[model samples]
Target: MKRINTWLISTWAAIIGYFQFFPQDLNNLWQAMPDDIKASLPPYVAKGVAFALFCAMLIGRSVNTHKEKKVLEQKVEDTKDDAAA
Candidate 1:
């Protein structure tokens, strides 16, 4: 379980970190649009939005997992205490 969590966190971190480095492919994707469309926004804005969504999901999942693990740990401890008593 711990190993899984470690791996997940590392994976998310790596993905987010990689995106932080500006890439040409994403720029191309953004620039391949028509001029009228391009006039509406900046290039990095779209990338930023994508990164924000990705980070949100990653953080959300991490928090939920941490909460669940804590709850389960507490339940286990309580059960052990009751058994001992």
Candidate 2:
């Protein structure tokens, strides 16, 4: 179950990473947008936003994993102490 969960999470991260890193040609999409809106948006704003979001997600995931590891380590230590007692 743990392996399956890890695989799924990794798969999702990879998929999102690809989209954020290598965006598809969206000339048609841009063409569809109104000139005023496109003009208002800052150049490279999408790339900046993507990078910010990716960093935020990775940080959150890292924090969660760190907490889980700490808990597991404490549990192992407690078990060893109990065995010695």
Candidate 3:
């Protein structure tokens, strides 16, 4: 699950970076979207939704990193104890 989450976060970050660096390309893509789909979402609302999703992904990644760090620390401590004994 962590691997999958990391992959998804990396993919999303890359996509966002591409759009940021290539606004003209993004604009062209947006123009190509179906009118009904575009009309269904007010621009601000769409931005807000995207922002919320990005925040959620960031938080999930942070939590996973924290958990992995704790597990690694514990393993290191266990190894030290075994060596000492």
Candidate 4:
């Protein structure tokens, strides 16, 4: 269980770190867009969209981590209470 947990954490970290480049990747994808499609959207829209997606990714991870930590904390408190009782 410990090894599996360690592996999961390492993989998760790698995934989160790679997401930091999402905006750059988005820019590259925008460059590859056909002219007609590009013309349909405003230039600044990409920046705004990139900001939102990246921010969501960051916040999502934090929220998930905190939720998990909270759950563990609750479980610990329950165990302590049981032991006291």
Candidate 5:
């Protein structure tokens, strides 16, 4: 699970970095997309969709990290109780 999370985060970070560093290339790719596909949605709608996806990824990462932290805390508490006994 940790490996999967690391891989996903790295992949997304790379993609974002690529777009940030090479915006013209990204723009070219977007412009090269089929006219009908582009026409199906407004530009702002596409941007919104991208933003929503990024937000979902961030939220998912946060949730997973929280779960792991809680599990670790529970383990520590159990260990302490065992030692005290």
Candidate 6:
């Protein structure tokens, strides 16, 4: 129940809600791309790629947040050790 986990979960939930409610928005975005690009990727394939990218983004954010928290914790521990010396 870490704060970061909760935030990430809510954010992902919101994103899913948005797409569920406005699926056409995603299609609009897809259609706005160059015709050549659209031709390169069919709608289903494009959607899969977009989903994968979103998942990758979520994973990257989670890793970065945890790394930052770890570094901060390490800094605090070092400070404590230094103070005790």
- Kindly give the number of clashing pairs for every candidate: 0, 0, 0, 0, 0, 0
Clashing pairs in 6: none
- Model 1 has an lDDT value of 0.76
Q: Which candidate is the best by TM-score?
A: 5
Off by over 4 Å in 2: 1-40
lDDT of candidate 3 over 28-60, digit per residue (tens): 777887899889976555445656787899997
TM-score of every candidate: 0.54, 0.58, 0.59, 0.58, 0.67, 0.61
For residues 1-85, what per-residue lDDT tens digits would candidate 5 score against the true structure?
A: 7788778767876776677788787678778889998889675564466556777888898998999999999999999999999
lDDT of 2: 0.70
Q: What C-alpha lDDT, on a 0 to 100 scale, does residue 41 get in candidate 3?
A: 72
Which structure is stronger by TM-score: 3 or 4? 3
User: TM-score for model 5?
Assistant: 0.67
Per-residue lDDT tens digits of candidate 2, residues 10-81? 775675576656566333455577889889986466556656666776677678788999999999999999
Residue ranges of candidate 6 with Cα displaced over 4 Å: 1-19, 22-32
**What is the C-alpha lDDT profile of model 6 across 8-82, one tens digit per residue?**
667866776687689898788888999998888788775576567668867877898889999999999999999
Judging by lDDT, tell me the better candidate of 3 and 5.
3
Q: Which model is ahead, 2 or 3, in terms of TM-score?
A: 3
Q: What is the C-alpha local distance difference test score of each model?
A: 0.76, 0.70, 0.80, 0.71, 0.78, 0.79
Give the lDDT of residue 9 in candidate 3: 80
Steric clash pairs (candidate 1): none
Q: Provide the lDDT at 55 for model 3.
A: 81
- Residue pairs in collision within model 2: none
Candidate with the greatest lDDT versus the true structure: 3
lDDT, residue 43, model 3: 50
